[model samples]
Target: MTYGYIGSMRTRSGRRDDVVAILLSAAGSLRELGCRSYVVGLAADDPDTIVVTEVWESKEHHDASLRSPGAKEAIAAAMPMLTGEFTSRETTVVGGLGV
Candidate 1:
């Protein structure tokens, strides 16, 4: 089954776009590692938060992505800009516009 992950990150003031940039830059690497979709966007009312929506082949694929080369690099690059602040929701994708 496809696994979906939505991660919300609140960066230290003025760093939301910075982290989004890092994620975008690392997108290709994650795509190569079985990430079906990696969508990055901002909350309409909150400029400090970045919302990331992802789809993976499975929950294991999603978990394994954390260890993927691109993910490792992205995490390292975004770590400093991040306040370690975030929220998330995981779900089993039964059906969707895109899997």
Candidate 2:
């Protein structure tokens, strides 16, 4: 089954741009990680909050990608822009409910 990950982050005050830049760089690494889809968006009601969604071929593929050098570097680079602890959840894709 396909694997998906969603991460929620909040940028430090006055650091939204920095956070977005970091995420963009992180997206580049994610692209090399067997990622089928990757997207980052800002929360509509909260400018400081960002949401990242990723789809991978499988859980194993996502795990392997986590250990990649690019992933490591991207994560390290993003750390400083974070305001609060980031949260993540993983799930399996079942039948889609109409969006």
Q: Largest TM-score belongs to which candidate?
A: 1
Residue-level lDDT for 4 in candidate 1: 90
Clashes of each: 0, 0
- Candidate 1's displacement at residue 33, Å, is 1.5
Off by over 4 Å in 2: 95-99
In terms of lDDT, the best-performing candidate is 1
RMSD of each: 1.2, 2.7
Over all chains combined, what TM-score does candidate 1 have? 0.91
Looking at model 2, residue 63 earns an lDDT score of 91
Worst 10 residues of 1 by lDDT: 26-35
**TM-scores of the models, in the given order?**
0.91, 0.83
Query: Model 2 scores what on Cα lDDT?
Result: 0.80
Worst 10 residues of 2 by lDDT: 90-99
lDDT of 1 at 65: 81
The whole-model lDDT of each prediction reads: 0.86, 0.80
